[model samples]
Target: MKLFRQVFLSIAAMLAVQGASAADARLPVVASFSILGDIVANIGGDRIVVTTLVGPDQDAHVFQPAPDHIKSVARARLVVVNGLGFEGWMERVTQSANYRGDIVVASQGIAVRDRVEEEHDHDSHDGHDHHHGKNDPHAWQNPANIVIYTQNIVAALSKLDPAGAALYRKNGDAYIASLNELDRWAIQQFAQFPPAKRKVITSHDAFEYFGAHYQVRFLAPQGVSTESEPSAKEVAGLIRQIRKEKIRAVFIENMSSPKLLQQISKEAGVTLGGKLYADALSQADGPAPTYLKLMRYNIGQLLAQMKLN
Candidate 1:
């Protein structure tokens, strides 16, 4: 009878533990787009259900939220964003929907890069500059900026779920370490091309951070957002620049249609280096699923096709 009672107590304790574990499950989350989704997944893991407002292959720069998107946001306990004016419509939509959840600005305290007209020569993407805030919103293009993202995520998640604080910190640390290693690799790979050959033109000015960090010169036909289709005159002007500068490659941005870029490539007589992930992360099965992987894949392809003869 004593042995049986001990066994019964052990079984009861195990059941109690399981019940408590289920009760402690975390809240539902919603990320503005793919990159945020990836970062949240890296930390949220199995603790929370995460839904992306704009997923991979979708253009967040021009994402018009649907009824389902609003429903998801309303149901979310937390919403992560890349703040700095990247998603202009986010604030209004969330406010309109009365979302009272934690809105985490992933790039909260990171040092912003200069994006004034004088800073860059190309006047192609002018008049559309949304450089109102402290820094450029394309912080994800520079891996160093990701440190701020990870930390902000850790703090936000901890505030929302104190019990999972340690787990969130651990995941952020691991992911940041991986991003640091990627920074080194980017420097090395980008070094392969001589300074003169480091120039490439694209459909949009989404690569300012990438160019600034890797010493590459990026000329965008359109403005910052992919939604801004350049006028025919602008395309002709870019074609002239490509011919005069003998630019190595014209890259197609993942978020934008390749049709416009193809036209530029054909007119300029330059090769389309590769597709660059300008605004969002790649699909789970694609090459640029994670932020780090996206950077490496983009830089590698650029180098391979843009290397000077």
Candidate 2:
């Protein structure tokens, strides 16, 4: 009996050591939001464990980080952010956590679009600078920009985890290929319609990159950030544009309030088309759970509504 007990104890100890080693092997990473988290997970694969500060279907513009987020950041070896002034609260969170790690800006090398330019192009006549002349942080709306994001992530991951450099490169290349394919698909899809029929309206001005990439005109009542509400004049101007343009494709963003869009649709005499995943992604059980899925789902929604227009 003593010999059998000793053999079992040795096996258990070996199993525990193996489990701990496996756990220790994975590098801990913290992403600013769900969309970025999904992208990091695709590139990092099983080599890293990711914790997202803003979860799926949540608005990052009004996000309030808690103690758990600080703890996650503190434990992470690397922190990833979208970094076009997207996460206004990120600085405070990182400082409070005392995180001493590499911070990766995923949108680092992309061609940035200015909010003022977007406002002018979209025919926003509100005369209000919603973003205060800041750059649009929704670069991920364009698949081409996400290619840059993927490359940046790969470089950051490779630099931190030298042992996993080859794996990161391989994964990043695959993701970039997928992104290219998605962009090509989008171009072809949008090309089928005339430029006049490529106009859409959503709750917020989050699709400027997307609009520029596919040559679609996206009109919105609110500005880049969901925190910025549209004034009465701004809302009236958008309603007039919708009526004048005969635009029937109206959508509500998954992360934004539907009330404003509902009111716009009612005043403009257009039915609410559907929900588009803009700043954040949907839950795992819903349509968009991953970055790729989010893009595809949003494209599908826009196309369906644009068909009516």
Give one digit per residue, the lDDT tens place, for model 2 in 165-202.
99999999999999999888888888889999999998
What's model 1's lDDT at 283? 84
Segments of candidate 1 deviating more than 4 angstroms: 1-24, 117-135
The 10-residue segment of model 1 with minimum total lDDT is: 116-125
Model 2 is weakest, by summed lDDT over 10 consecutive residues, at: 116-125
Please state every model's RMSD to the true fold in angstroms. Answer: 5.0, 2.8
TM per candidate comes to 0.85, 0.93
Best by lDDT: 2
Top-TM-score candidate index? 2
lDDT of 1 by residue, 103-222 (tens): 998988887776632223244545353454344578888888887898998889889999889988898899889989999988988787788888888777777888888998888777
* Candidate 2 Cα lDDT to native: 0.90
